[model samples]
Target: MMRKTLIIALGTGLAVTPVAARERQITPYIEVAQVLTADLTNDDVLTYTTLAAGIDANVQTRRVQVQASYRYERRIGYDDRLADADIHSGLARAAVRVAAPLTIEGGALATRTRSDIRGAAPGVLQGNVANISQLYAIYAGPTFGSHIGPVGVSGGYRFGYTKVQAPSIVSPITGERRDVFDDSRSQQAQASLNLKSGTVLPVGITLSGAWVRDDASQLAQVYEGKYGRLDVLYPVLPTLALTAGVGYENIEISRRDALFDAAGQAVVNAQGRFQIDPNGQRRIDYNFDGLYYDAGVVWRPNQRTQLEVHAGERYGSFSAVGSFTYQASKTVAVRVSGYDGIQTFGRQLQTSLTEIPTAFNPGTNQLGQNFNGCVFGAQGGAAGNCLNSALQSVSTSAFRSRGVDAVISVTRGRTNFGLGAGYANRRYLASNAGPGIIIEGLEDESYYLQGYINHQLDTRTSIDANVFANYFLSGFGPQVGVYNIGATTTLNRRFGRFNAFGSVGIYNFGQDQQRSITSIQALLGGRYSF
Candidate 1:
């Protein structure tokens, strides 16, 4: 990893280079920041500090330029002193303007993260190992313009190779053991063109298209998707106008192998699996498919007001959503949105989205099959034999939901404040098994609401408060509600430049599931820029 001092030192040297070019100049800069955090939970004491720094430089010469950057960060404090950092990412671009006004540039990306802290809970983890999606990429872009009509085109493409380490855990039922599946990698590319009517049409248009793919062994292979968009803008008067657009997308998943562990076992011995058949590889079998389309409109009567409405639907999945927003002033806005669809509710998905289910993970799902301890059937035979029976019982149904949101704020020079609220209700049906027959699971509904506000006392002082709460109503389960409140203040600039600040906040949550927890945390940090 590249340290801040090293990067800054290098930049300083590069900036002082005696380049005898009148049209070329080198710009270099660096930023360093550190944070100290503390946990105030009654049962445990957790403390930590993080330090981060980055160095960037840009050299512009005539019609060509180059830019590069490097960054490093460390996490220290609490029960461990470990650090994480990104070595360095460097890129150089060369472009020449042609008589037709065309230019092109290409670059590369290389970054990785390493940690030495132990694993724990979310918001409380002390390690960077939890995130292993690290890798490199190559990218390029081109732009063209000419007298060959009144149109211009610009586009870019990028391909990357990433390494990901899935969490080491088994599905608790079918006893399917977890193992390194594949070296996952994803690809994305995009292009767009703009049209202008210098002496003809009074409006302009832009068209764009994009494609992406993510491959992860038998799990998420064939996750390739494509998208397209068209945008139009028209001016009714000098300061008034209208805008509209439409978009479409498609995504699909491929079939793959499924792994299963021996009965009563959660993990297969590394040595045993390798020797069992010398060719025995685990696999999950299922397909996932879907697509989506959307259309939107925007109207701006004047400078201080605007209105937007959007609608979309997903085919095969039988789902649709609509939303609208109105902004009356600089600090006040309200939005309403709703949806009716079937959403995959679990983390470990088993089959294609088209295959919906009633009870979660019908029989022995990916998670269940991996966790061999639970008995999914009465066969009492081999563990893998009972997985099919479990999946056969899965079911699916249509779900509908509606929600409304609003925001208000007051601001004057150095002081600013705002509050917002939102509410939503979602209902869906599920299926469950009975003594001698399968029973239809009742429809379930949940409601959620949240709000927040903040104010600046002066150029060097500020305070903010916020709250989030939600309630769930289900037919098979009791009514449940959860809420949390928090506030923080800074004696220095809220998020100053080259300054330090400290803050403290608390949160509490309760649910009908008999689970309750409360937590408070404090933190202080400082930054320096050049």
Candidate 2:
């Protein structure tokens, strides 16, 4: 399958000629909006006004690429119950070719999500500081690739840091409050040697290895992984090829034990989590070491279309992976990708930042911030997998996740349309040896679908609408699940360099028969781009 990490994608960058007539813009704009929100489930009402200024930039040159969307909002509430808030959300990534064979790449992401699965919805999440949390992640790395005769040598090293600001959240299932993800530091190093076909006995050969580490502050936990793989490629036809690989991996996760009192009860800290003892005995959470293998097929009949499918044995089990991509100019795009790997809350957010399109028309919610877990692309609307599953719940445990995402988008005439769907299931890994024993054998699953439409009524007027539904099933029981649904539309008109828009949206959340929260919100705003 087509797999590329920051180490591979940044260092071994794809070479493309700079577009002569690209749509590049660096627009700085300020917006002031009056908002009204009413609770549908309850009888509460809120009136507020937000003052925000942000920048949306997309710039690409022969050797540099960058895209960013950021907003800072200060909300003034008319009622004391409707508290004021400061909200921030943004995503940015950049790559630069420092030399002919050296590349530097980095990205930063900030998002707001629910502290618990039972929190307020993303759209109507205003004034709910207890249930809302903000997360930040940043990573930078350099990759070096050079050719020594017929052999290709590539290597890279990366460092990442992630932090989350969470408030006190109480669980309804057990009425227990605990700490979620606080912070973590990640590091990765990789190197590879490649020999092209016909230069190495008519068969392509590649030997690659990597080492990864993550240090988390929750329980003073640590994750270490080492893997090496040798791959072979043989062409059976001009457009078809067979590929196989065998690898050995050693992965381990460990954490310190909690301090226990005289009665054999774990001592609780101020955050409701167990008190971690620095000098206590450390215990293994998960350990795996074995050989893995996979065989796959690659098909490419044209420049705009390619398909790759593979089946393999990995993580001590059987697995399947594949990718299909089609892009025709800036009008049409189709993509389907699959993944099966170990993931953490921080790593998942970091990886999602790498998938954002460098050139895109940023989409925003009623409050002028991008919706949770979704990113717009150059293909009309959202043209890539949504990151909803990655930001859903703030579970700090490492887990094995398997998922698939597909998007088909097209722009024709003065209308743009797109459809996207994604599914993910994560089985958490925690041993019964320490404080982690509380969350052993847990699982979480999710599926989501989203659709968007944009039509021009005139040269200066347009209407944009989108609808989304996301369902999550927790591991607490077979029938325990939460549903998130929302729809929003905006009517916009442009006059010179100034634009005016109004939007309305409704958000609904249902968790089994225990509780439900529903709200409707509206906004009227204008922005001046400079």
Candidate 3:
């Protein structure tokens, strides 16, 4: 049977500094790849060739920092004998110190990726299929803060927009495709004031408040919320501190539902009846308003180790937050953390953008920066690596999640190794049903473990290998359990400004009660940098 496959990819990049002493650089790059794919199971193989080009630029100074990148890809498939697809991705971020005590920051991200529904549902998948959608998000805000005498004050207003082109999916019941696109816009304003800088107040006190509003189209869901919080801190000793915080939050969501007639067809009126909310009311399913409080201790005995632990009540539920970090030596480090939080689909994607290196710059390498440091350093710098536990796709509704992450990395004479693990439990707040799809309230538990090792054979040669396994469990209709395992090894040879590498990877994903997929691929490529 023919299966989807990405065969070989080759890329080259060039970097240039515009001015000698100024911290400004620009890089332009291009890549070409060949893929062998099948749109469905037991289908004929189709050969596809793709070409991509991008530019990355960054400027940094004492008072300003900006980074941006843009990429475009065009693909041609032999089955159609035409360039049938064009893909674009871009990200930009800027932070400027408008004044000594004031700053403005903004960021925007746009990406196009294959939708996860194709794999989650019962269907044959192809890497080069047209099941692609774009996700766009932008946020801008200004923050001003300063210390006057023995008190400090700060405030900011932020505006954000998130848009996703929800792809049509084939329904298991009707076997017909339907559209389910949605968009959301939100605004948030916050302010805070604190005391005890130099007033000998015995304990530091901070007061903060925020207001947020979100409006979503298509789903006709509107959310408004207000939050107020107060925190106090006291130093018990030179290396330890006691911390406590109390907060109140209230959120409201507009009602949304589909109305169907006796004929099993959606009812309609002059105001786009089938698509509009019949009765605008509040949706209790999305309500999460209540009072919460927490108390925690922070310990920082030295520069190499720090720990924080807190336990609290949230909306009548138990909640906790904690983090621990330890630098075992100059070449080893460890980190562990856990948190409970409420999140929307858009917010989760935004969080992933902050943790992952999404920039397309020539020098931006996630593995090299987080895992294989010894390749560029003498004794290898002490660096910590964390597993990315973010959801792969944006869900249609908001959810609550509790998760923990941990990682350990060590570098020795000529070898570097790292291990990481993460787990999360998520509860969806809403259910959705459409022409071809039905999603009920879901509670999902996911976990993964990954490890990597890099070894230098000689001055110009190195080998790196990594493996990971992920398992997911979900409750409700069509209760599902799935696990995925993948491994890859690569050997690299350096030749001044050019490098040659060969890699082989194997991946397998399967559900306990259904079909499974396994793939193997080998690639040989060269990269040149300037």
Candidate 4:
């Protein structure tokens, strides 16, 4: 089941309308701005004027939804560091109920971003430097489910493809630029059956299983896994339920060269050379098989509050999951969630897609909803907001991560405010001794905090402000920790369909025990929307 939120019109004042009754809308806008920027570290100042044109369009109905944004900017001034480019960022998701028991859904996204601004482990990339990158991803699947005399059955197959384009890096040996990229194709199939006993019995039973495979071309990595679980639930009360479950999972990795000799002897490849097997295939590095069980409680005292908590043992390790959401009032809401899981990087993306339904906001693009601070601070350009670093690719390391996130938002007559914080820690399962290893695997932790406020000063004027900070730590790495802090403020005035805005921002980025780089930017622009 998926949850849907009502979309609210932003910037433009409009009443919320049901998707089924609303017509498609498209707005074309253009902005001419003068931008002045300075970097404190190099004491360099650059001034430029830019002309940008973009379009925003959205269509929503009972069976389909689409949203997209595209902008092209041309810079005219004396600045060797700036480049004129086209920026495309958007997400489109659609689901069609083909029949009573069948539904098909799919989504696609394209993004232009920078590596360093994305929160990847410091040693994950070759030079560990932030550079521009582009990502294109798409997934589609069909689900079939229906009630058959109190027994519900459903199954689906999802196929996904991801392509990443990263900036070229200079080769150490040749001193020439070379393209390094990551691309993967993956597929997942899952099925589940559940039986609910009405007044005749107090218990319900559910059985589910899933299989996944991923092939990453550039990294020469392949992963496959199988998982199964059986759950039993009892309704202790109308608002409370008890649950118990048992699960088993098996994971396998292929195309990985071993670090030892063939005779089971100790052989350390100091230079990180690859050793091929007799079958002309890379040796396996890691495998896992485990059985786990857990007990939990789901409590929903009322419509405004709900909480779920569970704990158990898996693979001889402790595991847990929990979440709480409270609609404190008509104007306030809060959510807290935490989870610990062992999964491959590809599977992580799949799981995130499942969670999107709960967080989806039609008013904003998919990236904005997922990486709020980045989209908010990088309103004018991608380079200004590196907060997307948290969503970086970690396919190089199969790992277990535990993380928690909390957010609260409030809305008043003319004001809106929000605050959020998150933390995550990851431990790699595979050893970092093989060839193509940029840096040894290490425990990595990251933290994020952001706050934002928007206020409508008058019928034709508004103001927006936001501040954010991010910190990352990794053990046994040259770049042990890196931190970033930034703040931005904007004021806008509207005259009919034309608007004028001014924004200023300050940012600081620093590596562990190193001198930080500080930058300041200001922009004044006018836009017309029609």
Candidate 5:
């Protein structure tokens, strides 16, 4: 599949290169990329490296454009003793202007991955396949202005299908089959309206909504969601402008004919942000939503000095942070910030695995149906009755969380660097389900820190590097700690009248108590103008 995509992209580029000579309208572009890396953690004997490469091409004329991309990555581990990882993905997009006020675009994307453990201990082989396909959308709106101003609308409907497969493993004790096979089909539609102000306001406001219908046998369902936003730009003064807006979003998921309940239906998202800017000298922004809110201000006292303040809230907890930045010279700048917050806890439950007994069948997947088959079992000697009891328990109280964040930055020449550190403490008690279920035990705290930097040679060339590390004292379930690092670079240039650009980044994710992930990515391509 990767080879075929690359071949088609190369062919299209060659076909569109001579459009200038033929006096025909055409645009062509291509990009290629590669990456290599290794892990240097506490282990010195086990080394892993990844390689990724890809190509992208685009061809467009006055009324139409076509784009395609393909990427492949492979991981070698244990001193090149094992082929540990692989990933392949592809994308295609095409758009055309059907009329003066209407245009259409569509695309398809797919990816697959596989993993194996050779030098490791045992039982570490894993693999999965993911595929999605969708059709294009055509949009139409008025070409002229409305009586009040310009009014326009754009929308599209998409039909998508997906299929996934995973390996089956036998329970260490029950010796039952535990592989997974899932297939899903879904359709989604979205539309939005933009009203330009010839009226009281000079800014435009847009309202949008979307709906998705997904089917997976007995798990088939429909989700409906909508949102609206009003935007306006007000000139507070010649040097300062203020932007204020608010929006409301809601989504409800319903099963076959049933009204969506809190457990089954998700609430719509409610969020908005407001901001004020005085050119580059000072800026203030307020951001908030249903669960969180923050207000930030930046003041530039001079060309070389800056001060900032940030405050926010999460539920019952509140936080505040302050920072200062100073340019020591034309080539160097430094900054520091401090933050703190408080947290509390209610009740939470730990998630664990249980074995299904011969009398009951647990079915499969998230939407899998349950039927009489085998009874279930748990770890150690605490199987059967003990496992069943735990599953039936519920909690009434909630957990409390509190945290603080601090940061600092430094920059020189074409390079800039940053450091961030934070801490979170949580308390969990017990809760009653009102009826019968009750939960118990869960108290923990965690701390984390990360740092990164970027270097840019010029507009067409730059590099970024970042690293993240996290740790937790103790938690109810799997460890929520990991280390991540990534680097990306882009190259852009022009040959005659044509222009091209491409970028590639590689990310490394150290395994956590839950799962481990590692991925290599690359993209490169260019375009020509006629």
Candidate 6:
């Protein structure tokens, strides 16, 4: 179909091929699983069977490379109240090098996630359409870098698209329908010129300009930002440098008014979103233009360790950002990153997809279901496991988000362990004169911790274990806070080209005081791979 081809072409054009071993693999597989789930709070039990088939591929050539995974699933159950049979979950990226210094890079992701922050936790809400939504995002662009004599020039332009599919959700407090994100288009462009130290002068000088914009269909929202900066780098030692940059930035976000009938009542569309007025005037929601500057230090004593830290001011607030990566030994790696920015749910998803490493080990459950909330990758700066954090509540209003995430991986003999943790805070921004006024001044905060361990029982058998805990605070709905905790373990054995697995998990979710719901599930499954 047209959709399948677009994913391939765009993924190839936007991927950055990392230095890796010579690997080319294409695996097609099928699986059948029996599942039994119980809801302790409501004393309800459901049993089902799922049949799934999928392909996993990685192909690398001299001029082209690609990595992708796709699957189709069907659920058979007597109770189909929440059995969403169509579940798509995967991440892909590829690249094609047309010239020595020029390449097209891109990535794509498809998954289902929660649409509202106030919805029940996903730990036990599988296939619940009221709280779940399907998402698809793809991005690709061309990048080129070359030196004209002593001056180095580089530039890039990227186009991104995101779509969300689900019905409108009703507020628990007001019992009224509200709009969620529908889709968005984003564009980013950057160009820079650099002159290294000692080649033309005693110090290095660089000039760069960048622009980014996002247009969302819901309420016809638009956000545009532009900035130009001049940076100076002074070498303090062979492996260390002090850097500073100054720039001017302009940013604005605008949206059109929601439609209203002659009776002065807001109009609601069939999909639960508010209708937009065709004659509505676009009103500015946020506007800021001023100086931007930062000072930073870069340290790289060896190829295995690197660190960059910066402190600056933006949008009339003090800002701090940094990233660190360290390869302790052949079996240990650590990475940490801090970020501050304003973004909508759509933009956040696209940025997270682009950051996912081109090389990764797909995370799956005992039922062979992907989107286990995270992706595991090799040691590097791009090896962020923050997709789990980015998969939070999706709202129509744009918000200023701040967060920091850290990941650590270790391997010891026959066992491997990984840990990841993060915190995020969002303060919503809404137009006072438009439909967005309802969500103004709303705030939400989240903290998450996750850990996993896997042990090889033998040559063909292993056990995988994972545990997670999260706490969330929201001011958008009647419920003030919620906490979710869960643990799962799977035992696997392989026989030639066939594999079998069994898993058990217990999840608990609590909202408002001690009002809690508990879910327990067990699964048995087998797969044959060719």
Worst 10 residues of 3 by lDDT: 1-10
RMSD of each: 16.4, 2.9, 8.9, 7.5, 20.0, 4.9
Off by over 4 Å in 2: 1-17, 22-24, 116-120, 126-130, 168-175, 260-274, 368-371, 379-382, 433-438, 476-479
lDDT of 2 by residue, 100-137 (tens): 88888787877777655545445454455345677788
Per-candidate clashes come to 22, 0, 0, 7, 39, 8
Full-model lDDT for every candidate = 0.35, 0.73, 0.56, 0.57, 0.33, 0.72
Worst 10 residues of 5 by lDDT: 343-352
Question: What local lDDT score does residue 516 receive in model 2, on the 0 to 100 scale?
Answer: 79
Indicate which candidate wins on lDDT.
2
Ranking by lDDT: 2, 6, 4, 3, 1, 5
Top candidate by TM-score: 2
The ten-residue window of minimal lDDT in model 4 covers: 1-10
> lDDT tens string, model 3, 1-530?
00000000000001111234237777776655554543233344455565667767877665766667766667666664334666556666566779987777666666653233223311112343233456677776777778777778777666778787654442222232322435677676777778962266888888878777777764566767788888888889978888888888887655367565567565543322236536644454566677788888979999888888878787578888777867667567666767676655555444433332211122222111222111111122223323244443344456676788786767788887777788877776664543322343567677767777888899999888877777766543455676667666778888875667776665666777766766554545555544
CA lDDT of 23 in candidate 5? Answer: 24
* C-alpha RMSD between model 3 and the true structure: 8.9
Better of 1 and 4 by TM-score: 4
Looking at model 1, residue 498 earns an lDDT score of 62
Q: Estimate each model's TM-score.
A: 0.46, 0.91, 0.75, 0.78, 0.37, 0.90
Answer with 2 or 3, whichever has the higher lDDT.
2
Q: Name model 4 segments beyond 4 Å from true.
A: 1-23, 49-51, 70-77, 83-86, 99-101, 112-129, 168-181, 197-200, 256-280, 328-332, 357-395, 433-441
